[model samples]
Target: METSRKPVLYSYFRSSCSWRVRIALALKGVAYDQAPVNLVKDGGQQLSSEFQSVNPMQQVPALKIDGITLSQSLAIIEYLEETRPDPRILPQDPKKRAQVRMISDHIASGIQPLQNLAVLQQMGEKKMEWAQRCISRGFKALEQTLQETAGRYCVGDEVSMADLCLVPQVYNAERYKVDLAPYPTIRRINKALLELEEFKTSHPSRQPDTPPELKA
Candidate 1:
């Protein structure tokens, strides 16, 4: 049960940032070890000193690989993109790559940060309403962005980092009761992405740490 050949990933089933990295690793055919950090237990395992040593930010997706630890979902992904160039996650064209990053940033920074667990926990009773409004506004902008940049996937027919980022945000939106009916392009792309083996396997429901009651 103990093997160090594969890189170790510190993750949580429901953390969308962790989900992004999971999807990327599966898509690239990289073998990794999953070390689940239960975010809701003991007020959050991520906040513990042990995990903080791995990621000062105490985030769920702290990857330990290449003899070092890396944190921040996007940064860990970019490192993978750089080191493992085959089956690329980014496009060859500079403009297209920029477009992909633009949409990715829109979700990662614009939407995700606003509705994260800490923020929602702070909002308490108002969290549901606040998160719904935040998701609606962000999705409105994202739908417009996708209308221009998407073609089957967020950037083009090929799956990019944008699509990886998109699916989990949409999942989070659903959790907050944010309707997806208005975002036709997002829904279309998400449906297609869900069908992929990589995306399907990387879903929260399929993760090892998913509770028996929650697993698909």
Candidate 2:
């Protein structure tokens, strides 16, 4: 079901979820086009009817590829892993693979969602405080888990889906001004990951739609 047509990613420059997909695409060395969906502009372009048709969830990281459109960052990445296995993101070992999924879920489901833009919008004046609290709590647990599973990357020295989830969540934490001092393992891994070419190029600051003032 492969096609010569390049995949198109619908993304927002500063979106953590979209950034995860960007990292996966870069790591896989898959060339793609971007359809920028300015989440802040025009009262949120993701809410538009046209974009909703692309992803009913109205998410910024919807991927149009292989004659189909896929929503949800992890699912899209898994699809890529299945179709393009070399330079794999998931570990081949069963236990290590389970650990990778566990860490990825810990951040993606347990942490990231709690601080998502829509969730923060609903918190009104309490948004910043709430986001900080959520990230701090999640990072506390993640740090403990990473101490056991991490080896050069999130799972046994190979860059896995967990690493993809970690970098963006850390970005969100910094945006919310959550202190990173307590999460030393997380900070250490993030620093190492940031030095990689794939992570650097996929970073929000370098995105095509990143605001001029925010570009790195």
Candidate number achieving the greatest TM-score relative to the actual structure: 2
Clashing pairs for predicted structure model 2, backbone only = none
Error of 2 at 88 (Å): 0.5
The C-alpha stretches of model 2 lying farther than 4 A from their native spots are none
TM-score of 1: 0.97
Q: lDDT (CA) for every model shown?
A: 0.92, 0.93
- Error in Å for residue 144 of model 2: 0.6
Q: Counting only residues 3 or more apart in sequence or on different chains, how many pairs clash (N, Cα, C under 3 Å) in candidate 2?
A: 0
Model 1 global lDDT (CA atoms, 0 to 1): 0.92
User: Where does candidate 1 stray beyond 4 Å?
Assistant: 1-4
Query: What would the TM-scores of all predictions be?
Result: 0.97, 0.98
Model 2 Cα lDDT, one tens digit per residue, 33-128: 999999988999999999999999998799999989999999999999999887999999999999999998999899999998889999999999
